[model samples]
Target: MTADRQAVTQVLSGLAEIRPWYQDLYRHLHANPELSMAEYATAERIATELRNTPGADDAEITTGIGNTGVTAVLRNGDEPCVLIRADMDALPVREATGLGYASTATGTSPDGSSVPVMHACGHDSHVTCQLAAYRLLAAHRDTWSGTLIALFQPAEEAFDGAQTMADDNLADRIPKPDVALAQHVLPGAAGTVMISPGPIMAACDDMFITVHGKGGHGSAPHETVDPVVLTAAIVMRLQTIVSREVDPNDVAVITVGRMEAGTKNNIIPDTAEIELTVRTYDERVRTRTLDAIHRVVRAEALASGAPEPEIRFLSRLPLTTNDPAVTEQVRQAFTAHFGEDRTRPKEREAGSEDFGIIPDLFGTPYCYWCFGAHDPAGWYAAEAAGTAGSDFPDCHSPYFAPLLDALDTGVEAMVVAALAWLGTDRA
Candidate 1:
């Protein structure tokens, strides 16, 4: 075996000895989840773990960056730096997994709803894997020469944490990272990692449309302008934009997730509203899709003889693009550490990630890969049942669970990638 592979094997073996502790940490975070912008306890727990870590030095805890965000710095060398990020916030989903460590923690949302919070999106697992990788890198600092910035960010689900940190000049304050790396726990193909070269994730924009009309008695036929009809027409026409306007091969998705109009059956409402999410893989498509949406809404409303619709863009997330050269480097590192069988080319994902903002601002190379979360039983059952829709609960679902046993593999993969980038050893 090559020297680099030998070193990776040694690190993996060492990681095995401490896997139990990492699992415990994952369980702890899973059981006590926190919501976005309210991750005070979560941040404190992660900071404590980093402080207790063997190679952790000069750990700094800063709060209120993106509203309840925390960033911890770990340095081993004074050379060029790279940043590894892990999101720390959890969803306000009620636990339904019935696991022993299921979350019973409760929090009040900004909307004043009492909800049970859990790590249903697997942010807990992300944080745990990040800690494990940090420990391994620290233990083997002698093998590489560079700086490591381990960021524990908050509010990824809301998709504003990365941008908030960047706006505060987080990168310039620390060693400016030449490249940024992050990973998401996916619910597919256990024991495998998936990555793509560019535009791996889609840009997401939330749109709200309010349609105003004349409120009158239901008995009136021609006297009232019915916004419900106008809203319905708009939703139906919105789909045509994707099917007819956009190229079928381009992968643009426009979904109207919510619609509300009237509260009383006997009376026509004065206003109707619809909320939609627009997703696209390219900037040109993103702009065209949005502009088309507005045009369709206005034209439909005018045709229906109703008032103009009020359109608002609630929020947006940029597309995640992986630099081709950096992605090839990562693939080479994975091949050197693991066998050729363990590494495979990946396809584009329709989902969005806040990490995309880094590449938008600094023009730094960024890549976010998927870590498999299926167990043996889960994998077989899914395959046998032909229900492998999603191997684990989706990121925002209430039942999202991660396989802790596979974490060591993820840590080792990250270590190999980091070492390869530092040009310390080659197999």
Candidate 2:
């Protein structure tokens, strides 16, 4: 191995020493997950851990950046600065993983509803991996010299946590990084890395639509202009936007995930509510798709002789495009560390993320990659049988839980990637 590779391997060897502490930390986080912008306890716990870690004692830690976000800065000497990010918020999904540490925690959602909160997206693993990586790097300062920023962000599920930090003068708070890096837990085999050059994830928009109508007794159908019927018609018509309107060559998705109407069977409600999401890869396609949705919704309401429908957008996430040069650097590092079989080119994902917002604010190049944390045997079996999609629980699912071994994989991947920029060659 070369000098830099040898240094990275020596640093990673410390993983065996720190593994137990981080595993316990992951369990604690998984059990006591908090909602978006409400991660007060989570932020405090992370800060406390940083203060208590031996080599990280000299680090300067800051809390409450954008509310419930935490940052720990470790500056060893004059070297390239690298910002490593991990989201801290949990989703409003109830846990069903049946693990001993499964979350029974609850939190108030954005809509002020009491919902079950779980780390169904492997954010618990994200935080654990980042913390372990920081600990390893801090302890082995002699191996690599540079400034490292570990950012624990909040409200990623709401898709605005990064933006919230930027709005709160994040540029004034932390050191501007030469490069920003982030990673997510995917549902593939554990310890493997997945990466691509550009547009790895899609841009997404969430919309809330309400159609107004006349309420009446269930027995008096003629007196009521039913909004439930109007909403159903609108949903059906909205499907045509992708098929009949958008080009088949391009990709776009319009999904009406939720609809709320009357509570009682005997009464017709005055209004019907629809919560839908739009996903697209291209800006022009996104604009056109959104325009088509507006036209269809209004036209359907008019055809149903209902009042003008109310439409509001929320939780807009930008396309996660990887910087080509930055991505190639990280890809090389991953291949060297994880070997050829474990490091493979990734296909573009339809999922959306707000990570791009942070690097964009500073105008720095950034690369976001995914690491698998699933059972390797099971994942491969499912893939062989063409049952991967149905067998493996996805990020938002209640049953989604990464294997324990993923902690080692994530920490090593992060350390290797960070060392790519903060290597001894630069020192």
Candidate 3:
């Protein structure tokens, strides 16, 4: 490793002092989870935490930037500005982790329906580590000269807040960045880092489809056009899209996450609703997959003599491609702090992130990495004992939870990365 890279270790050490405070803050955010665009209390809590931290002295904090989003800027001089981003939104999943801090909070969805909320995606950890980095960035102003743009964006789970912030002229409000960086917690040995070049995550789209039909008594199948049977056929056909239509070399995942239909077993419902999420690495594959979905739904409905199916797109995010050079720089920085074995290449995930949009708005380099949140030994022990519940869970699972080690390791890696790239031009 280069001497410059070795020196970054000191940055991690200096920032390690704030890890305890943020660890406590992470539990608070996790317990009081909120949904996308409804992160009012979450944002307020973030603002309060920042006010009590080191950066609060010189930071410029703004709230409701994109309907509950917060942005804090701390500038030391004329050097290049680095924007570190974190998302603040919880999923509509009931708590199953059974942790003492597991959320019992519920949020109101866009449709005005009550839904259970949980930090299944670890945004809570991301926000807490972000606060730790902010405090250190302010305390170590002499170690680097530049502006630090700490973006606590909202609704990332919905894949629209980054764009919404842009629509609201986010770049106009704060000092634009020289480079952008962010991270998430994924399944791995605790304290390990994972990143890759090119496409780090898939482009994703959520679609809502409703098959309409005439309602009738279930006893007389001939008397009714069965939308439930039609929906089943449509769901099965949607699965074939990846195997038969998409190229073998390219990857695609189409998951029907939700299905709702009849209220009674004896009554044939007039309509059945389905919610699906599609993921692809290439734009061409994504377009083809979407087209295939529409064709399948419409054709299946037509075959059942159902009314025109209603198809509504819920949300979308372009593929997240990390700048190769910037990613490698952090990879080395991570290796420097945690050793070469602790930092490794992570296979690109089928899941998506809205962070990709930030680089386009600022026209700067960005790298989004994931650190493992679970204990390595415990994860292995569970696997060996054939105990699934005791295993490390994936993000978005109702039972997903990361260990306390995530708080310190995340902050250390983030602090070193920000310090390493703070005042330099993107190569």
Which number leads on TM-score?
1
Candidate 3, position 25, lDDT: 90
Misplaced by over 4 Å in model 3 are 1-3, 92-116, 210-237, 256-274, 295-310, 380-390, 424-427
Q: After superposition, how far is residue 360 of candidate 3 from its true place, in Å?
A: 3.3
Candidate 3 lDDT at 271 equals: 92
Kindly list the per-residue Cα lDDT of model 3 for residues 1-427, writing each as its tens digit. 5544544544455655666677789889999999999899989988887777664576888889889889888877756788999999999999998998989998898999999999999999999988888887666565666788889989998888899888888989988788899999888778788878888899989899988988999999898999999999999999999999999999999999999999998999999999999999998998999999999999998899988999998988889888889888888778777898778797887878899787779888898988888878886577478773446678999978899887777888788788777753221
Candidate 1 least-lDDT 10 residues = 418-427
lDDT of 1: 0.78
Candidate with better lDDT, 2 vs 3: 2
The Cα error of candidate 2 at residue 240, in Å, is: 2.4
lDDT comparison, 1 vs 2, better candidate: 2
lDDT (CA) per prediction: 0.78, 0.90, 0.85
| Residues 234-265, model 2: lDDT tens digits | 99999999999999999999999999999999
**Per-residue lDDT of candidate 1, residues 1-427 (tens digit):** 7555655665565687778888898888889998887888888887787787776666554555666555656565666577788898888888888888999999889899888888888888888888888787766666666677778888898788878877877756566677778887777656677776888888999999999888899989488988888899999999999999997778799999999989989788888999999999988999999999999999988987888889998889988888888888788778766667656567777878898676556667867787667675776588689877655576677776666666766776677766656535522
lDDT of 2 at 335: 91
Angstrom error of the Cα, residue 251, model 2: value is 0.4
